[model samples]
Target: MPTDDMTARPTTSREDGLAAEVRTLLRTGLPIRLAAGPRLLGLRGVQARARRPDDPSSLARALDGLLREQLDRLENTGLAEASRLLFGAEAATSGATLTARRQAAADASGYEVHHFRKRIEPKLIDLVAWQLRRDSDTFMARHATAPELRAATRPLVLPADVFAWEAVEHQHALARLWGAVYLLRAELLTTARLASMDAPATETDAAATRALWRHALVLAAAAEYRAAYGAALLDRAGDTDLGPDQIAAYAGWTPPLSPAADLILVRLADPDGSLADFTARLDAARGGSELTADWRRALSGRDRDTDPNTLPAAAPEGSTP
Candidate 1:
């Protein structure tokens, strides 16, 4: 929407639609996000917020409605426009204009764009899991002293969809979330998507730059959680019965499992699954599968995040890893 590009070029219908999306988020989405939260400040009242661990028939209806709205938005939204609103200033090539940066994302996304969606699929699955963690935390904080907690646990982990439905409604809140996913995917595809093609990237390339992004967000999230909630919340971030695998569905999530910080590590752990199958596999895993660090070993050379000698060696596949 900000029409200032150093290089002038013809625009397509999708480009125009992207510009409209940018305008919509900047105008409408941001405001809606600022208001909807655990506080429920601008939203009507207590009745709207979930009170217990139970997911009833009416709750299913509400979540479905929320999902439909979110899917509609996701269907219409452009990855580039989203980039502009979220990290465009940071992601933008320093010398390029806003229009140029946006155009670059659109180009990287491709004309038809369905295949391009595949690039970001795994990260989005991880996003849903992280979103659930945050939403459960928010929901519990809101109902901290609720009567239901007398019979249940603090920071009660609810169904993943409950958190996801709430997350999609607060667009700006989830921008950093999806931004990390998009940026990570683009980073992985630099050789295939950017270098061999004719396009500009607002960001991507330069491992140092990519590493900076990786650290920057994680540090920010960790610091924000500590500042917002402090020592009192730290005691609640755990569960004795759960291992890392089952923790996804059960943690109270103190300051550590911050989506931008800790959960990003899990997202980075495996980047191979296609989105459609990835979510299904995660659901199956949650039902009962040992989480393993085999994904970490899959990395070769510089892709390795940790020294092989330092990490526990990978377990054999299909065993109770």
Candidate 2:
């Protein structure tokens, strides 16, 4: 006796047929065609989710839900608009003629009529076909055991958050500055912890320890500048006297060094120890070139070329990935 066939196999032909059907629905732009397309195509996922698989109204609603959910996930605005126009997703265009839909898609995508027909339209159809297959597979895997699970697993559409490039960069720079401040604080705490435990002072030289403290002070000052600058940009709920250029000048502002920082600079400048040298060095370090250089470096290091929309793997400092 021959064994029954139980192996799972790819359905390339069925998928191809579905893709062709989706293309027809997109190109026809006729209500009668769209209303009958999903049922005629025998979309298993749509049928499975519909209250009555055989009912055309139920299948149409299910298909609409799937398209809307997937379309909302698309980040590309132009492609989204094209898809919407082509599929008559908006009520205003539901009764539009095929030529009108084509022209609208071309205008939305910024493509010429010939180019949109030859390139963009095919891509739109393929995108829909792929979305349908993915949703179908997901529904089948989750709801095969109990059809009642469909309601709980149904997808929701939410608005996408879009930010300007400048705003994104500003926020990213602020984040980097704050991150540097936290790291410097952690190092300071660790040093204090070691001192409290009476760890060997030989681990770090006196000069190196002083340098670390100086760096921490400078970084903290930079972080403060960035916070105030960012607040000036975002806190626009009320009227302010400052103009845009005046606000921007804050980026290059030089903060005065703290007393501790001044003392450290004095010690570095005159290790031999003299009252006159201490006084002169302390006065010079208040807004000196060295302090300015350090502040500028700290600020520039935080101004990375990273895209705020993505979270790429960490790279070495001062390196672009």
Candidate 3:
């Protein structure tokens, strides 16, 4: 009945170990799924046979665990925050309509124009990035040794302001990449489910995702502090070469769960005050940082067309490695 009771009264080592694992997975997985009733009870039965050599309980349970883990992660990490951000008053009232929001900037003043360059933009990007960084922490907490967490933490630092800046930038960048990636992931999941109807997602899809993935990877690699890695990833992603395969890999894209959506929605909701308010918020969030450095350099007669020789070659444009 109770978790401790089951493990404490274990029948055999193999059974005990299996039961413990099943419980661990359920404890973690169920919460992630917000599971109740049937799913929970169903897993219990699966757990029972996990120790039976004749039963495929262990493998089946592992699959369920994996699926549940992914589902839970989707719920807990990004989707959760997205709800708040998107529906929040601010994002809902921004000056731009969905049509306008989707339109090209055409000029330098509309909400569509320089959305990426706006100070608020990067703040939102960094907000999501930080949340992601935190998610990484939770993932590591379960498996990381003490020293590892300490060492890992070294690279994640950001002046709260700077971290916040990249958070906004990355969020928009991700949005650009999201629609395409979701379509791909949906197709992959569908095919995986109906193998007879369709082919499984191929290595090509994985390759297509290289640009976005590599951008994220590079940011993680270049961060001044461990925590900043996520920020770095978001900021540098724009520079990465996008390709077909890299595009396909991003099919699983989902809105990040963070305060970002709230900001966007807030701006959307208050057509009158959204810009002014968002601008003020952006300034508050921007504590001192070199955030505008790249953009500044771009504006100061620096060639956007030429990659800086000082900076390492950006992964051969679209090459993943």
State the displacement of the C-alpha of residue 87, model 3, in Å, after optimal TM-score superposition: 51
Report lDDT (Cα) of residue 131, candidate 2.
67
Residue 153 local lDDT, model 2: 67
Q: Judged by lDDT relative to the true structure, which candidate is superior, 1 or 2?
A: 2
**What is the per-residue lDDT of model 2 for residues 104-123, given as tens digits with 9 covering 90 to 100?**
77777778878888776766
User: Which candidate tops lDDT?
Assistant: 2
TM-score of each: 0.21, 0.37, 0.17
RMSD of each: 25.4, 22.0, 29.9
Tens digits of per-residue lDDT, candidate 1, 1-321, equal: 322121222233123243233233222222133222322221111223322213333333333233223333432244434333322322343235434544454454443234323444223223222322333344323211211214555664546796555544333322433344445445444423443453443222332234323333433333333444332222122221222122121211111223332333343323333433433343344321122222212221232465544543322222112
Clashing pairs in 2: none
Question: How many residue pairs clash in all the candidates, one count each?
Answer: 1, 0, 54
Cα lDDT of all candidates, in order? Answer: 0.31, 0.49, 0.31
The candidates, ranked best first by lDDT, are: 2, 1, 3
Off by over 4 Å in 3: 1-163, 192-321
- Which has the higher lDDT value, candidate number 2 or candidate number 3? 2
lDDT for model 3, please.
0.31
Q: For residues 21-121, could you state the per-residue lDDT of candidate 3 as single tens digits? A: 43333223222222322322233323332333134444355344433333334322323322122212123323433233223221212333344235322
